[model samples]
Target: MSKGQPNEVTGRIFDGATLRKILAQVQPYRGRFVATGVLVVLLSGLVWVRPALIRIAVDDAMPTGDADLLLNVFLAVCGMLLFEALLQYRVTYLANWVAQSVSLDLRSKLFQHVAQFQLRYFDKTPVGTLVTRHVSDIDGIANVFSNGILNAIGDLLALLVVIGTMFWVDWKLTLLVLTPIPVLLLATRIFQRVIKKAFVDVRNQVSRMNEFVQEHVTGMHIVQAFGREKQEAKAFAAINASHRDANIRSVWAFSVFFPLVEMLSATSVGVLLWWGMQDVLVERMTLGILLQFILYVFMLYRPIRQLADRFNVLQMGIVNSDRVFKLLAREERIEDTEMARAPEQPIQLRGTIEFENVWFAYTDEEWVLEDVSFRVEPGESVAFVGPTGAGKSTIINLLNRFYVHQKGRILIDGKP
Candidate 1:
C-alpha cells in the first residue's frame, strides 16, 4: 500500500491502557520476579510467625513452667527473624536487578523509537516536551519499577500473611477489623480521581513554565533589545503562578488523601480493640491471643498503609504510562511504501534537473504553484527573480522533494 492510503497513520493523546503491555515487558525476567515474590512472601510470612511464637511462649511455655518450651520458642523466634532478614535481602537483590534491567530496556526502546520519527515530527513538537518525555517520564517509569511495582508485591505478601494469621486466630474478629476496608477503598478511588486531575494540571503547568523559561532564555537578546524585559517577566510570572497553584493542589490532594486513609486504618484498629476487649472479658478469650492479635493488627496495618500509598502512585504511573504509550503508538504521517526500492548505487549528478508541468497545493482548494516549469543545466546561470507570490521558495521546496506534487515529473540526474 502507498504511504497516504487509509490507515496510513493513527494518533492518540493518552495511552494508559498500554501499561499492561509495558508490565508484560518484564516477562523475560519472570524467573527473577517469581523468585523475588516468593522470597518476599516467605519473609512476610515469617513476621507472622514471631507473634505465634510469642503467644506460645506466653500462654503455654511460661504458664506451664516448661523450660524446654521457653528455650524452643525463643530459638524459633530468633530463627524466624533471621530467615525473614535473609529472605528480605534476597528479594531486594532480585527486585533491584529486575527493575534496573527492565528500566534499561525500556529506556533503550524509547530512545530507539524516538530516533525513528520523521524529522518534521520533531520540528512541530516542542523540544522541552520531547526532552521531558525522554528523560523525566522514562525516569518516572523506572521509579515505578522499583518503588511501586516491587513494593506492591511486598505489600501484597505482607497483607496476605497478616490477614491469614488474623483469620486463623479468630475469623469473627478478623471480619470486624476488616469492616472499614470497603470504606477506605471507596475513599481511595475518590482520592485517585482528585490526584489524577491535580497531577495533570501540575504536569501541564510545569511544562508551560518550562516552555516559557526556555523561550525567554533563548530570546533574551530580542527582549533586551526591544526593552521588553518587564513584559517577559510578566509572562513568566503568570506561568509560574499557574505552576504553583497546580503543585499546591496536588499536595493538598495527597495531604487530605493520606490522612483520611490513616484515620480509616485507625478506625479498623479501634474496632479490633473493642472486639478484643469483649472477647477477653465476656467471651473468656486469653490474654496472649489478644496480644498476638494486636501485634498482627499492627503488622497488617503497615502493609495496608503501604498498599494504599503505592496504589496512588501506581495510578499516576499508569496514567503517565498511557500518555507515553499513546505517543509511542502514533504512526508517522508519511512513510516509505511497501515494496519501495532502495537505491543500489549513488547517482552521480551533472548539476542538471528538470521539473515538467508541475501542479501543487498545500490543500486541494488552494494551489500554491500551478503549471510551474523549470530547468537547470550544468553551468546554467539562471536566477529566479519575481515578486513575493512568485513561488521562489516553493520551487526550491518542490525540487528538494520536501512536498510531493500532485502532477509533476522531477528528474534529478536522470531518475524520477
Candidate 2:
C-alpha cells in the first residue's frame, strides 16, 4: 500500500499531478503533437462533407436527372474519403511516433532512477514490480497517446460536428435522435466506474503475476532442492487464476457496455426512421435530409461508443502514470553531499582502514553490528573470522560504503 507499489488499487480514475507529469514527457515532441491535433481537426471537419455531398446527389442531382452533377458529387465524395484517409494515416503515425519516443525516454529514465536506488530498496522491492513499471506500465502510457487522448479528442470533435449537422438539417429530428443519449450517457457513467475498478484490478493482478513468476523462476533451484515444487506450482496457479479473473471482469464490463451502446444506437435510428417517415410522407422533410440525419445518427453514436472505450484506455494509462511517477518520486539513494566532498587532488591510497565505535543495522529493530571498532594498518593482513550473520559481511559492506554506518566514523587513510 506504499507509494509506487503496483498492488494499491484506488477508486479514483484520474490523478491531475500524474497527468501533468505524463504530459511533461511530450514537451520534447511538441511538433508531432501539434501536427496530430491539426490532422484530427481536419478529419473531423471533413466527415461532414461526405454526407453533404451524398445529400446533394440524392436530392438535387437525381431529381433533375443531372448525371453530370451526380458524377461530380460522387467524385467529390470519393476525393474527401481519400483525403480523410490520408489525414488519418498521418495522425495515427505521428501519434504513435510521439508515443514511442516518449515511452523510450520514460523507460530509460525509470531504469536510471531505479539504478540509483540503494541496495536496501532492492532487498525490499520485487524485481518483477520494477519490470512491470519499465515494460507494461510504460506501454500503457504509450497507448494514452496513440489510442486514448488524441483519438478521444477526434471522436469528440466528430460527434459535435455530426450533431451540429443534424440540427442544421432538421432541428426536430435532431432533438428526437438525441432522446436516447441521456440514457446512453447514464449507462456510460456506470460503465466507466465499473471498468475503472476492473482495470485497476487487472493491472494489480498483472504485477502480482509478474512478481510471482519472476521470484519462482529465479528461485527454481531452491524450490527443487527443498522439494517445494508442488507448493510453488499451486501458488502460481492461484496467481494465474486471479489474473484471469481480473481480465474477465474487465472484459465483462466491456461486453455489457458496448452492447448497450449499440442497442441505444439502434433504438435511436429506429425512432428517427419511424417519426421522420411521417414527415417524409407529407413532403415536409426531403428524403435527402432524412437520409442525412440517418447518417449523422450513426456518426454521432459511433463516436460516443468509441469515447467510452477511449476513456478506458486513458484510465488505464492514468493508473500506470500514477504508479510510475510515484516510483520516480522515491529518493532512497545515498547522497554524497557537500559535507562529504572529496579532495580536489586524488589522495594516495595507503591501504589503511579504520572503523571507530561503529553501529549499523539493516532495520531499526535489531543491530547487525554494535559498538564495533577495528583498524587494519597499511601492509597488515587482518582476517575477519566469524560465522554467518556475525557481522563478517557487514564489516566489508560498511568499509565499501554500500551501507552507511549509523554511529561512528569509517576512515580511509585517517581521512573521515
Candidate 1, run of 10 with poorest lDDT: 1-10
TM-score of structure candidate 2: 0.96
| Clash pairs (backbone) in predicted model 1 | 15-322, 16-322
Q: lDDT per residue, candidate 2, 351-401, as tens digits?
A: 788899999998774899989998999999998898889999989887767
What are the runs in model 2 whose C-alpha is more than 4 Å off? 1-6, 337-343
Top lDDT: which candidate number?
2
lDDT of model 1 at residue 285? 81
Error of 1 at 26 (Å): 2.1
After superposing candidate 1, which stretches have Cα over 4 Å from the reference?
1-16, 64-72, 281-283, 333-341, 345-351, 356-372, 379-409
- Model 1, residue 255: what's the lDDT? 87
Residue 57 lDDT in model 1? 89
lDDT of 2: 0.87
